[model samples]
Target: MAGTIQQIAELAGVSRGTVDRALNNRGRINPEVAKKIEQIADEIGYVPKHRKKADDTVKQAGRGKRIGVVTQLSQSSFMLQVNKGIRDASKKLADQGIEVLVKENASVDEAEQMQAITELEEEGIDALAVMPVDCDNVRVKLNELTEEKNIPVVTFNSDIVGTKRYCFVGLNNWQSGQTAAGLMGLMMRGKGKVLVITGYFSNSAGSRRVDGFVEELKKNFPEMDLVGVQSSFDHTDEVEKIIVNAMSAFPDLEGIFVASGGQAGVKKAFDKLDLHKRPYVIIYDLTPKNEKALLEGTVDFLIDQEGYDQGYRALSILSDMLRRGRTPEKEYMYTEINIKTKYNLN
Candidate 1:
């Protein structure tokens, strides 16, 4: 039996990523650690498999291939990191003779996404990566792209149900919500009125987080009263208004959770209110604005969904499929749910 990368990593007491880098000879690692990893692999009868060298495979398979990427909520702060990942991956793929076309949408509108897809299809895209709006039409479009058009599709950041997408690369939104609920529970001492703010109700990512938070709150923090759950549509003004109105409605709101974008609006709301004390706040993303809020003690916690990895991996997965015929090991490639605070901002 051949030893797996996970086994080697476990034996070396290192991360799987480090093991992969050491074995593949891609990326930097401590020389001593790399030596130890190699020794472990040799002792365990590990054999690396590759059809061709990485560069050769990319050059051969990517020569004439094109990939299309469509992302929603383009104006949000979180998207900066995601787009950076896309741009970096695009540069790498371009060097290998592949063209990556990107379409950014400011809102989660099905019609807009459909139009973007149509345009990309007209451009003869070989594969697609999208942060799809959770709607019946978008789901149908994804299915058509994969099944009828013979174009592989990878969904990222947000996903829709009942789609023939090859895979999804992003956070497990439900678990992220549960994490928020636990954090809020701990902050409020398991009892307080809390408000929930979401980016868009139509987005499965946000909705699932809200659902998970609600279920976890009910099960564990029963005394924590949920004042309301409002959608901000990823708009700062909308988020500000929602927070202000919720605060007015629940004067004793003890905690607030923002499950998606518009975190700047949270600080704006705090400033506008100008209260002696503010509600304990939890937000998603590690954008500059959110980091500032945490540093200033406006937010209690920030949950990062690894937006960069979501963008980079989605495109990379599609490229691998088109270039090397490699299917994703998992249908849902969930990124890590990292919790950040001022104490551990790094």
Candidate 2:
């Protein structure tokens, strides 16, 4: 710690009045006295914390943001929901002069995410909000962005450790998935073979949802056998392939779970196979497509996690951190999880 005013005054061989005025820039002190004090402090390597007024002035200068948002991919409804959240959050800060420039990777892979993040940096944004593709590389990238250019970052929807980031805002995925599984187990009376498909195991959110779903099944309804799990990348064609294949392999598959995107595809496969008659279906993300499926009874239950709201919450936290120096201490935020059935889908 730096010496107090008394010590500084004694060391500089000046009175405490001279030391105080010089340090505070009160302009009453002579130039010689101020120079001497500053020289002594520099020689001693003394740097002090900023006072409250000084801190507030600096933070107020950071209020209006020039922001860039990096997303996983643009194909899925889940990403669409998160984008909506960003828009709503930026709009709320519009009168305050904040601006958001959004960009997306074509896929959830290290190369794509790196490309998107790098492009966002080239845009010269003051701060960033991103859904990183890989936890390991993403953390390193974030550290580089912040340390090199002094740009702060916040992660939304997925988490990466070992670097500085502003915040993470997304669904409580495990709990949400567990809730989905529980709903499925209850609807089936805990005595059926269930098949669960996700976007991919590499993606953190999809993996967590699977873990939560399986954990919930184990804890809540062990009798319901979770037959097998597969990956879809949440695409219509890819998801169609998996769901159709799984339906054939698990002929007695009584219940279904789509833990990631591609809910509409799952419903479509079910319709084409005429399998909807037997297997009770539960998929995620209540977008317009899935909402329509819910209305028609093609999808039995839809766990609607509002992606847009997560974006809003994340941006709000990042803005507050940069502008007000307050970080969200809480781990997660609550998103809308609407369990919609055919009758109530409307």
Per-candidate Cα lDDT values, in order, are 0.87, 0.73
Query: What residue runs in model 1 are displaced by over 4 Å at the alpha carbon?
Result: 1-63
Colliding residue pairs in candidate 1: none
Q: How would you encode candidate 1's per-residue C-alpha lDDT over 72-97 as one tens digit per residue?
A: 98888899989987986786566445
lDDT of 2 by residue, 110-213 (tens): 87787777887887677888887755777788999878888888777876667777556677788888888888888899888998888867687788889999
lDDT of 2: 0.73
Query: Candidate 1: what lDDT?
Result: 0.87
Backbone collision tally, model 2: 4
**Model 2: residues with Cα > 4 Å off, grouped in runs:** 1-64, 92-94, 146-150
lDDT of 1 at 130: 94
The most accurate candidate by TM-score is 1
RMSD of each: 6.5, 15.2
